[model samples]
Target: MRPVRGRWLSWLVGIAVALGFAVSALAQDEGYCGDEGVWLQILGSGGSELTDQRSAASYLVWIDDTARLMVDAGSGAALRFDETGADMAGLDAIVFTHLGAATTADLPALLEGSVDAGRKGLLPVFGPSGNDLRPAIGDFVERLIGANGAYSELSSFLTFRNAAGYKLSVREVSATGQRRWSRFSSDVLKLSAIPVHHGGIPALAWRVEIGEYVIVFAGSFSNQRDRVANFAKGADALVVSHAAPEAARGELREYHAIPSQLGRVAARAEARILVLGNRTSRTLGRESQSREAIEQHFTGPLVFANELECWGLPDKEDELP
Candidate 1:
């Protein structure tokens, strides 16, 4: 009995020591990293097709630990955002690449969630203007939240002067040219958008520069390689959709860049990192072949963005004196 009691006591002591060390290590890590850098999180990385493997396209950009910008509130994005434990109150702006259901379907959900989480004031939203086939972003928002439209209750529930206290201000950009427009600019960040070709549908690409880190999102462009290359020049990270493989043809090729094209574009832009997002089963299944094709052109670090994964931005090295 005495020996058994000794062994039990020794085990308890060992467990306590291990727990103490773990706690100390956690504290040290928190102290060292403490919300001082910019980070990118993939809220949903799947394409338009409904699948159990991944959510539709969405992303979050965090600056100094604050979730400041969101791109695309796609299907299941709100749930994924909630899982990140990021304060919705800190979200300042949302940029929708297009008005496709797979890209903007969850906007109402995210707005409602933000209001529920005590977000107050106006939230700016930027999206492409209307073409012959698509409605402009301003009209799209009204259709979603207008007094006589779907989710009309949201207008009252989520207002700047309402009890929850939050409202959305929509801005639409022309979808006619390769001209770059400044969306938002502040001391720490600058955002720019450019019109891109997407099967005659209104679409746009976005570039964000936070400090010395530059990230470009090439949203659904195929034939406009020059526009995309200019928009993504010298990007620290370039995110390309993987919906269309090299074998895609006809109308399908008009909307999305193939794997080889994506790699070539990344190389042309001189990007340091290439992130393949909006992945479908077709693309995911051909990962090895796709990767090899991408490597043929782009020599940078290629990353496959997955849902809820966070990537830290590496600091730019100082130039020689």
Candidate 2:
């Protein structure tokens, strides 16, 4: 579904500033997902709808106390990233599901800020290969920061000619088949992506591996392929973009996972916990129905993720070597 960016975003700055204070206070009081584990932090849990007054789909993967990985920087996500007190420069990589505005609108805003900060580091951006509708991630970045791009003023991101001395390493992956690409692998983290069905739109489902913990970001997907089930098998946490609820129909239902389908996928994947993210107002208002629909198959923990909520992954160090 297309994310509507309207005048509501003008109201976001003030509301976010006020909400940040309350959330920060709550975080200080209750403590966060701990400083020793792999934590899945929801930055923006709302869908493309401007009606919710929430930031669109974005997330962070915190390794220990530092935010090391980011997934999808959607509308208002740049602001949410700032509010979290995260060091944008410390991020190892930023991955996108598809190049929709709901998942990519704030990218240049974020990178521009990083450039201003004079952060010097090569950051890799991983995203899906495009079809006729969308440009591949590489072309997408070139269009934004290439020598003669829309933001040609910030073309240094491509050429690295400026003092900040940072350049984007764009890695475009294909989501055209059953093949799952091993995108990034390091001592602390490993990432893999597989093709997912989002109708004609090229999309991916990411699997993040940190130590013994596994987390899945089922970006934006429909249940027709069930690619996520196998890709996310044995995941400790599965973050599904619940953009459409069980009652949604036609194109709305075709682009996103309905609650019942989500449940079956979670159950099949055997994910330990399911976090429903990228929420729409419709899904938010019908929580009872969605929960019932999901619980029918996935009997494990079900979390209706709220922005800034950090869910810790329990340690399985002993189980791993």
Candidate 3:
């Protein structure tokens, strides 16, 4: 192992995750992973860039042992999802941040797996409305499985006639600026969505409250309108996209949050910990510079994420940083 040193250590998680860990060594001997608490595993952490090897953005949320939620399903996500030994039948919902292919390209392939797994319950799918450039999520799913769609045979997922004993309940949340949609509320889980601007891409950010743990997936947004801070307030873990480097401009700045803005968002929301994912080749080797940029406005632990890394809250109250 390399020798531990400097302030950079503080920016990384030292919790000893088999998947990924921050370097801070927050004095946690055993990280909260696998406990009764809520844990988040990144299935795919990279952007849709063809030059990179990392899978597209995907996430798996585990409550105890069963995977309860899947945040996004970008391309190459299915392979990583299956690697975690999680079954689709156990998922409570598969929520999308937007209709972008980087966030939904793996839907057909993932749903195709459900046929073999024989899921027996309602799998709720959530996403945002669309514009002329992008199809609304309902139309998006229908195009994949409707009677005259590409995968017409799989239309059973939209109906109740399949012997598989399961059905998909897909809902498109409002994409109006700063709007809120209380999508689901139950004893086991509670979910809320807020419209966020992704350069007119029609996106929404999501918050999932499982038991007492709160997780926020900011998705891929520029936060130019600043809807994320209030929507993500007081989260245990906030996952944001820092897909571009410090010097990026133009379209890159429009589609994703820059490093400095990422700091302000997490800090303003008072998120206990901030996780950086949805990486790209441009941002991969610039962690040091990004860390410097974020530290200007945020003092909390800043975690740079890797694929399949499971992050959990500290098991004991005192273990939290």
Candidate 4:
């Protein structure tokens, strides 16, 4: 009995130490979300190019223990997902903005991990409708685990279903200018998607709303800025790819938004915060360029995201609500 009691006390001491270490470590990464709100983490914030400066395109939205949504599965995102050390079973949905290699590359890896963990069927995916968007999701999934899926037999362990929980009914609407709404129950999060420009390919951008907080993710914009601006208006947080800067306006006129232009849109929309993702070396070095441009038009908080970085919604008390 004495020996058993000693072992139990040792276990208790170890647990207390682990808990203390956890709290201290998380102090920098976690914060108040409306006093008791959602927290967002950057699973990966790189662009198409995989460099020390960037990875690819991916963002992980989470609230405490619940994973709300995953946007884009870039080249290295699969590895980062594991590195995030977050709960995968809590991941309710995956939303791809386009079919760019950088965007959908890591999807198979993610799905496989789910299967290994005992997922029984299909997973919910939301994105654009046509060849570039819709077909890509199907092709990728089928290729990965379909009857002819690259790893069909192994893929059989999982299931694919619609937001309504029907397998055959999993219809991906990949139409541009079209909008779809999906609600995440555990966190009461709602997401609305619209096709944005990824070099005119079937790409999409999404606006996610949790309670009163709004987060808009604008994929590579090669099309109408006004169209996306309308969707981003008054957003609580706006994330845009940083492919253009005011200094290089002439070079970027074809497919991207200059930093100032991005800022102007955010200011016009009355967005509370701005996060610049999908950034490149040119834009990164002149990071001040974006700040200057955005400040020229808007005056709000701004963050230049890094790989594996994490952020959270402002406390409700922090807003004018």
Say which prediction, candidate 1 or candidate 3, comes out ahead on TM-score.
3
Best by TM-score: 3
Alpha carbon lDDT of residue 256, candidate 3?
Answer: 87
**Residue range 15-101, candidate 1, lDDT tens digits:** 434564211112111111116577677788898686647889788877886778898988889888887767778877789888889
lDDT of each candidate versus the true structure: 0.74, 0.78, 0.79, 0.63
Two-way lDDT contest, 3 vs 4, winner: 3
The pairs that clash in candidate 1 are: none
- Model 3 scores a TM of 0.89
Clashes of each: 0, 0, 5, 13
Candidate 3 residue 75 Cα shift, in angstroms, is: 1.1
How well is each residue in 153-197 modelled by candidate 4, as lDDT tens digits?
Answer: 545434453222223112354545545444434346777776665
Best to worst by TM-score, what's the order?
A: 3, 2, 1, 4
TM-score of each: 0.86, 0.87, 0.89, 0.77
Candidate 3, position 71, lDDT: 92
Q: How well is each residue in 166-193 modelled by candidate 2, as lDDT tens digits?
A: 8888999997988889958866899999
